[model samples]
Target chain A: MSALPEVEIRIGGIDVGVEHDALLASTPGAGACVLFTGAVRGEGGLGALEALELEHYPGMAEESIASVVAEARTRWSVGAVRVIHRVGRLLPGELIVLVGVASAHRAEAFAAAEFVMDYLKTRAPIWKKEIGSGAERWIECRERDADAAARWIGQHTPTGESA
Target chain B: MLKLRFFASIREKLGQGSLDVRAAPDVVDVASLVRHLDAGPMPGCAATLLADNSLVAINRQLASPSTSVEDGDEIAFYPPVTGG
Candidate 1:
């Protein structure tokens, strides 16, 4: 009753205008589209963050993101998934990344998009250095992110198998 | 000998991305190697990188501190992921 969705993955400075256009244009066959954007906060409470430098293992980062997208596709009857992560120097308030998922219904799209982000936050091999007033510090993985990923560990797959 | 590679913040702190060290006479594990590295001429940043938990990959696969290393193995050290 529904067609397979499209998926796009990129690593660059996310353009809100472009992303909005891409999602709107690509969702004609779908009724629901969900987008998640993560940005750098001015004050992380640790110190006054001047900027964040993101570094990623070139081929590995791409492969990791692609794997997350593939897993999402297998678990949900989703249409499309678009992920873009920016690398290099970024100031506070700048966009870090975006995850967009589209499906015929709201539930599938929303769940899949969240799943993609949760996986990316943990499994992806990307590092960030926070330049702040006191001193620059590399961010450590948060326990909350691990918890989010764990929630999907035992869920039944759309294909009748564990994802 | 094994080659240890560092990247991102770790590399920036150490001021060198890679190093070569002879394998220990007995079987040497990742923890020993890390201790040796930490005892090196580490600067403030280099010390800070190790202060918090770090991730290690032996030949590009996730490895624990007790992972073994043999001659010619490639090891990488990196900070916890912060990417989407």
Candidate 2:
């Protein structure tokens, strides 16, 4: 018998470091932790950016991330996973997302962290509107993100490396 | 009845977040639900129906066009996820 992987998903404006500490505290005997942060860029190809308005389907957004983290646990020896995404109005350079994974080694930690982020981009029920240069528009989804997440779909088994 | 919800640009364009409508016999999946919402001249809905980026979810689960949905289920449609 084994305990389920620890998972945390949050939607709000808060520093990712705060969530990282909480994720680490939840997993005992994990030797490696990988963390990633996504920040609102100060500029875009269209023009200078002022801020971004993030909207999300409340219940669905949380559930989607939970599913993503659960998949990561199945693919790796992940002990704990935390995903924090901020909604509402945000200025340039503000943190918009965070993903952290705790594992017994670096490979699993890195792979699980990236996997969580890739799925979050495409699977989560969230959207972003760019506000800049006297204009605003919804940011379109990127094809590269789908490609990133696709790479994980069939490769459920580890690549024979020491993961 | 099925609760249909929209978010982000779609919500702004539609001028409402949600609407409850009696599900037709064919409205048993997400694709049909989208078609049901497009029953009127909703320009914004046209994008969601035509664009490849639009995503759908039923009962808090990411769903595809063919995903089965039941009465009282929540169906949400939104533009491709941009959040990290």
Number of the top candidate by TM-score?
A: 2
* Candidate 1: pairs in clash: A5-A79
Q: After aligning candidate 1 to the native by TM-score, how far in Å is the CA of B11 from where it should be?
A: 2.5
The prediction achieving the highest lDDT against the true structure is: 2
Over B1-84, each residue of candidate 1 has an lDDT whose tens digit, in order, gives 888777777677678877887776553877767666565533243354444577778777778778887788888888778776
List chain B TM-scores, each candidate: 0.76, 0.79
Residue-level lDDT of model 2, residues B31-53, one tens digit each, is: 77677667743434755554676
Q: What's the CA RMSD for each of the models? A: 5.3, 3.6
* lDDT per model vs. reference: 0.75, 0.77
State TM-scores per candidate: 0.74, 0.84
Decoy 1 TM-score against native: 0.74
lDDT minimum window of 10 residues, candidate 1 chain B: B41-50
> Which residue pairs of candidate 2 clash?
none
Interface CA RMSD of each prediction in angstroms: 1.5, 0.9
